[model samples]
Target chain A: MNDVIKLLTSHRSVRKFEARELPEGLLETLIKAGQAAATSSHIQAYSVIRVKNPSSLEKLVELTGGQPYVASCSEFLVFCADMKRPLEAAARTGEDVVSGMTEQLLVATVDVSLMAQNVVIAAESEGLGICYIGGIRNNPQAVSELLELPKHVYPVFGMCIGYPAHEPDIKPRLPVDAVLKVDSYRDDETQVAAFDSTMHAYYQSRKGGNKDANWSQNLTPLFNQKLRPHMRDFLIEKGFTMK
Target chain B: MNDVIKLLTSHRSVRKFEARELPEGLLETLIKAGQAAATSSHIQAYSVIRVKNPSSLEKLVELTGGQPYVASCSEFLVFCADMKRPLEAAARTGEDVVSGMTEQLLVATVDVSLMAQNVVIAAESEGLGICYIGGIRNNPQAVSELLELPKHVYPVFGMCIGYPAHEPDIKPRLPVDAVLKVDSYRDDETQVAAFDSTMHAYYQSRKGGNKDANWSQNLTPLFNQKLRPHMRDFLIEKGFTMK
Candidate 1:
């Protein structure tokens, strides 16, 4: 396989990073790449906090569901879905700033995700390995407090990036036919059940796989019970209206 | 600047691509990288369609707000926020699929965005240039018919990727101070205005020192009135109950 193809096909999350500091302008360059991503309406409703302070990193690591990866990485960043700057822009220019709604929240959230991926890509190209800490959402209040995040700007996720100390095996994915459709959407139970077996095998190959190999079983708890339960309310409290 | 950093920082939308075919396994690698992105509830609620047929490309270009760029690139993909898979999964197994609503739509949309960004990054790392075609949303219904997309699966955007034929300057972004904040989200008018000026200068420079320069003037119409006016309706039509 081509080198780039190999890199993409076999990407693994890096949990350990070298303690060495990153080279200069790396953060700026990453942010630039992120900002270059396509935004809905060019709103660019996102921001990144470059957390280089070790004490702050410690606090963040704790807040991020006690994930040690947050502290171990040389560079940590929190991507924020920000609407405050645009609101401020409208305020100064005496323009209407009415998008404090749920729709706006969704747009900003999507926008931040797009930008954050760009950051990940840029970091990877620089020979850096990064892991996303979705655990950051486990305690959103604390994250907001630590980051001094104001209303209409919420932490979407945390990313830890640095030179890799250890390389993990590439995680397997559902087959192309399982996810890719030519025209319209189609679903076959047999295909999913078959894919479930494949996923189970993938898990068995790893020392620590999901508790249950069944994709549905693993997914039930995530959506049926937890995840984004109060995100809308949280956004509302933070200054977004779900209108 | 490092080669990787240069790639990240200097990325520009390349509407024109070399007719050269992608290397073997590259497409699969790109799709895998996309799948590895974080999915809400691990539902992986998205699908990608790789268009190789010229007639299909022409049809898409016509449907995508008549953007010639969509037809010009070597690889064209329409990213879909797909809920049909899990919905069907539940139906086949007689499980309740209760959450395929507005919130679910948000999850799928964000999920697809992150995945698409991963593909972009992966492609760029392999010396590919990409342009996101948001105009696909302009006439979602027509595009849907052309692509034979089904209910509950809507195309979020179209992406064209391949080798570049032009080297455009990196677009400027709002200042970090204006966008980034600590701990609570803060809105600062003066900072935003200054950044807007920076944007104006960047645009002016791009326009070869043209007279008009304010960023707001260039963007306000799109967000305030056009492009997004009926997107909510489009979502509803896709069988997403935005409750």
Candidate 2:
């Protein structure tokens, strides 16, 4: 197997971090790797805010639904899907300001995500561990204020990076047939069933021997509880019409 | 510097591709790497469709606004922001279908992007080149039909992977300070101005010695012409309420 494949295949999320600072210059190098990732039309519509201050980290943890790992991690970065630069550039160049458009927000959001993934992979290759905090979006306005995010820029996600304190098990996925379509999609019930079985076994055996909730049972309430309800008004208030 | 850092830092979009077949098992390995990237709450709401059939590739090129690279590339994969799995899971468990709401869409979109970025990095590490194709989104309906994408799953982007026929120069980025915010968001106008100068030099020296357009000048029309128009209705039709 290729080394990259080996690293990627057995990948697992690590939330527990050792109490250590990063090696010399790793932060700068990782950010550079992030900046090097592709941006939409080279607009580079994103920013990485390094939270080095302890008080600021505590605020970030509070904004991110009190996730202690976010505050306690060795390195915490909040990736922003930033239109502030482009908005400022437009102001400088005397161009029009596009208020409340889904197009711009979508581009910026995806752009930051692209960069964030590179940062994670680069960190992984250096033997650093990573966990993403989607909870950053839980309270976008608070996060924006704490991070001093200007208008047209919003926190898309946060990443906790450090040496791992524990080796989390590799999470199983739906089989390729269920997810990877060849020329067309197959919304096959059997495929999902097979995948649910795989997921159940994974939860049962590897994930601290937890009871295996099949794919449907685990997913239905998730859609009801957290993600589906809160995110719409959040994006709207953050200047995206999502038209 | 590490070889991975070199790959990440030196990445350039390769428009021209050499006529070479990928080694066997390369695509599978790439998909595995993509699947391993973090998903929101482990929902893993995304999929990729490999477009190997020539007729399908040709059609996809047309749908992608005549980006001929779509047809010419040795391997083309479409990254999709999929909510279909959760919906089907909901049906099996007697949960609501409207549950795949805006937040769910956002999660899947971010998840798909993270995976795509990993695939790009892994592909480059293995001596291949890739260019992400946001144009695949130009005609979502046609793409859905051609790829047989299901409801609640939209095409987020396409990717072309192959050996490079041309070695392009590394594109310059905004200066470190321009994009990297500290504990708080701060914009230094002087830094932005200086970075624009650096970018002008990068473009001038690399591409035939012509005077390069400043960053603001380059982006003015991009935000005007093609990108700002399409997303709202497209996303709506693809089943996101954008609530």
Candidate 3:
């Protein structure tokens, strides 16, 4: 396989990082590569905030529910789905533009995601390790306040990038039968059951430490408890009114 | 620079494709590579439907506002943000799982976008061209019914991947200053103004033909009208009640 495919398939979320910082100008080049990813009609409905201040980094580490990688990584960035820029640009053109809509929220969200994935691939190509911090949503309000993010903008996720301190085994995934369906959706009971067995073995044999949970067993907490109930109200207040 | 970075920076959306099928097993390998991308909390809230039927391809071509590439490409796939699978799996394990919440919608949307971007990068690495069809949301209901998509499963976008018949110029993007900020958010008026001039020249001298418009000018119609207003009600009906 080519380097690109090989780099992609052997990917793992890197949490531990060496103390060394990224080489000069690498972060700039990585962000440029991210801008090359496709945007919806060139709207570029996204913005990234690089947290370089040590105090702000510590605050973010706390905001993300104690993910220390936020403080230790060579660089940490919060990717925000930003419709404000395009809306303001369109308004400057003297068109009667609206502020927020449900579709606008979706477009900005997807646009940011596509751009961020390119950033991930570019970082990986440069021999860097990365971890996505979805736990940012655990305290989106506090992070938003700390970042001074304005209206019509919301932080979707965060990323920690640095040189790897350790190489962890790539986690097992659901079989293709469970994800890639042909022509129509099908029940995945068989595929899901089989994957649980695979994951059960993976947890026990993984490098970090042994855990006794499988796929479905691990998902119990996420589903049983309310998962971040404040998100809807937070999005509305941020001008994602979902009209 | 490595081949991966070069390939990524030079990516262009190929509308015209050579009428040849992919090498055997290439598609499966590409999907596997896509699966390796990071998912939020292992929710893996996404599904891909391979659209091979000629009539459905033609219909999708029409559905995407006469984007003929949908019909002409060697392969077409619809990437859906699916919460149904995981929710059902959690339910079968005797957990009282809630179906539709605002956070659920956002997670699924981000999940599917990340997975689909990997698919795009994988396809491009193997010398294929790809275009994402956001117009699928224009008439999402009809398309969803045709694909037999159930509740909590909605198509985010469609992709056409194949060998390029023509290599178009890589369209210019907004400057990095406009997209990336440090410590806090900043207004991008200056960068946007500069980018508008850049896009003006790009539109006037492009390969296909000269067009009289810039970036902000082009966004007028999108913001001036209630773009995709039907999406709000459709998502609600499809079990993405962003409550």
Chain B TM-score for the candidates in order = 0.91, 0.93, 0.98
TM-score of each: 0.84, 0.95, 0.98
lDDT of 2 by residue, B1-243 (tens): 787777789888877898888999888778878888898888888888888899999988888888898888889999998887877786688765565467777788899998888888789888899998988867877888888886688888899999998888888887777777779898867877887788787777885366758887787776544463667787777777666
Local error of candidate 1 at A158, Å? 1.8
Candidate 3 per-residue lDDT, tens place, A111-167, comes to: 999989989999999899999999889989998899899999999999999999999
lDDT of 3: 0.90
Q: Which ten residues in a row have the lowest lDDT in candidate 2 chain A?
A: A222-231
In model 1, what is the error at residue A149, expressed in angstroms? Answer: 2.5
* Worst 10 contiguous positions by lDDT, candidate 2 chain B: B221-230
User: What's the best-to-worst order under lDDT?
Assistant: 3, 2, 1
Query: How well is each residue in A1-243 modelled by candidate 2, as lDDT tens digits?
Result: 677667766678888999999988888888888889988888888988889999988887778888888877889988998887876775677776565677787788789999888888788889989999998888877888888887778888899999999988888877766667787777767888887888887778875668848877888777555453766776777776575
Candidates' chain A TM-scores: 0.91, 0.93, 0.98
RMSD of 1: 3.6
State the lDDT of candidate 1 residue by residue for B1-243, as single tens digits: 555455556666778778777888777778787887756556788888777678888888887768887877877899888877766654444445555344566678778998888787678888889988877777787777777777788888889988897766666777656555443345656766776787777777773355564656554543342234556666677776554
TM-score of 1: 0.84
Scored against the true structure, residue A36 in model 2 reaches a CA lDDT of: 91
